[model samples]
Target chain A: MNNKNSGGSEAEDLAKAEMVRLLSIVGRDRSADAFEAIFRFYAPRIRSFMAAKTKDRQAAEELMQETMTAVWNKAGQFDPARGNVSAWIYTIARNVRIDAYRRKRPEFDMNDPAFVADDVAPADQEFQQIQEAQLLRGAMATLPEEQLDVLRRAFFDEASHSTIARDLGVPLGTVKSRIRLAFEKLRSSLEGRL
Target chain B: MNVKHHLSDEFLIEYAAGSLSEGWSLAVASHLALCPECRQRLHAMEGAAGALLDKADESANEDEAWARFKARAADIKVEEVKLEAPKATKQTVVLPEPLRSYVGGDLADLKWRALGRGAYQILIETKDKNTQVRLLRIPAGKPVPEHTHEGRELTLVLAGSFHDGEELFARGDIEEADGDLLHTPKATEGEDCICLAVTEAPLKFSSWIVRLVQPILKI
Candidate 1:
């Protein structure tokens, strides 16, 4: 309803468009500079991505590199017609990080054979990640602003109920209930589309 | 192949966080193949994971990280490998008869093997060595050896019942456990006890021989 929100959505759309264009070139021609550009753009950013879950810098670097290699190998699979490239690459990095974490610790076997194969890249797997992200983003646009913000803070910021309550000037119980209700609504809204 | 045993938001978050066990992770993947809802949740979690990964410290990098990675990439001309191996796709993923009856659709058939007393293994289809997914079925009335979780365990009860400490699991109940808890579960009475267990590590059997056999068994 406000200019700022509209501008934010527009910016996201533009980013998505640029990502699609770059991915298209990468997919068709491995030699294209698009790959290099993407590498440069995301490589630094991906380091921090890994660091959030783990404290080790060496491990984060390893996962970041693995994530980039996937981008290079799976560039051809990106379909601009479906969704944005950021979501696709993000999904790839996410899975690579998960795999890297698994390899570092020798615990029990929780490997997904579907994901473990040497050749099956993230691009080759279902494209649902990007689609879901897109759908959730769209669904998020439909929610009441207060509920949407509460869900984002609770899940994304990992804010505690008390912290969110104090910050938002609401009771801790209200914050907790709002987040729970918001998640339930989100689940119901996206349940069928997923 | 139990549609009813869909991965939940909590499980998806843990999976994205890389906190799930190997066996349980495999089961979730199989479930993902059948349920798009879970897959979608995973994708969203992937985004959140990206944000999480983005928060890491920026000052450090592995000394040989780029060189090692480049060497590995140069060694292989990575291309489109289908998501499912032929064997994985070909194997009729045998579900609990009740679950099988509910699916009413084509399923990935899998090879099932017995893993000592009370324990059984089902080879779920996977795409690579890195993406290992399998199904471990512990039949009714049998209790696993008391053990600490190797990594993160995501257990979704497909049918029957199992108990860990004071809690009991029935159909569709999900339990997420990790190294923090050491416990044993026995299937409840009158049910064959079907469950979808996903984990990133093989169970560390208390017996030394079981550990030795683990490498050979390739579980």
Candidate 2:
């Protein structure tokens, strides 16, 4: 167990380092080699993500391509100090999917009054986000399997509380409480640190 | 601003997941502009989503997808435009970031149409057919007719305060009401209450006279 834990942390460090290198090369020089490496690493994963949402192989592939194209175009905006590379990429994927849906219904203009540019925390807050993220990951690992299962369904599938409760064969309140408990734990774990 | 109420976790999750309706997302985004705590929470949720993406199973068409993507990337011209910082607009009523770009001017610039009984409203046009958003300015000590929502209604107090027979909502407080809630909200005596209200469907006013004019009001 100790060896496994250390190995997991070592993998995380390596992944973080790779992401930093990729962002620097893409942002500074627009290097094709770094772009190729990022494409190979993220394309399959992003395709899987789109597949889960669209459930159509052709549509998923189209969205995956669009998302990667966005990454290449917006590489200069990627600030590792603001958020982790994976989170930044995930946001791009999510927005691309949403934009695809919005395109189908042409009436919905993306430049509507209610829309606002996303806020990027100051550089000073970067350490707090990174530290909080690590703490959250550790907190997530300690959650009970059942709680984690519900959270995973909620986050990945975008399942509503009622839907998760129905799927798990539990009362609605139980599902809500489980989610609340999980968040409470995460918040408490990183309370003083933040 | 010391914001007391905030966007709920459910709403934040929906926003982060991109599952929220355009109208509702706008309300949340407006609130997010005013509340740093909620923004931090949203960032954490995004981090959680990213962690899940890291662990998700990979697809089979990785090689083919990469090849096609590479071919497409070669033809695209990536712009190197730098994002400009938002300029501070000198206005009497300082609008928050989300609303600032929409109004383009201060409170005086809005072409407010008088809603009967001293309440003025400006209907903001949105592309979403399912949801309608409006800015309502209630004169001090005036009461909105008792009403029940047909669908969900989210009201954010942009300026001043109002009492909905139960709680006092000040600036930056968001009150979420659904079909089940029915109440008459009145502006407090000290100042006029200005609210940003988003509704999925038109409201059901309690008074017969108000209902008769509801079609004309288009609230």
Instruction: Tell me, by lDDT, which candidate is best.
Output: 2
lDDT of 2 at A67: 92
Per model, kept true contacts as a fraction are 0.13, 0.32
Q: Per-residue CA lDDT of candidate 1, range A3-120, in tens?
A: 2322226555556557778878877876535765566557667776666556676776778887888888888777665555655776677567656544421221123222112333
Off by over 4 Å in 2: A1-8, A103-123, A145-155, A160-172, A192-194, B59-61, B89-93, B100-104
Q: What's the DockQ for every one of the candidates?
A: 0.14, 0.35
- Clashing residue pairs in candidate 2 are none
lDDT by residue (B18-62, candidate 1, tens digit) is 554444444555455445455555555554334333332354343
Distance (Å) between predicted and true CA of B84, model 1? 6.6
> What is the per-candidate TM-score for chain B?
0.53, 0.90
Best by DockQ: 2
**lDDT of residue B131 for candidate 1:** 35
Candidate 2 per-residue lDDT over residues A65-136, each given as its tens digit: 999999989988887675477778888998888788772111112233322333555664777656655666
How far off is each candidate at the interface, as Cα RMSD in Å? 7.8, 5.1
Give the lDDT of residue A167 in candidate 2: 88
iRMSD (Å), candidate 1 = 7.8
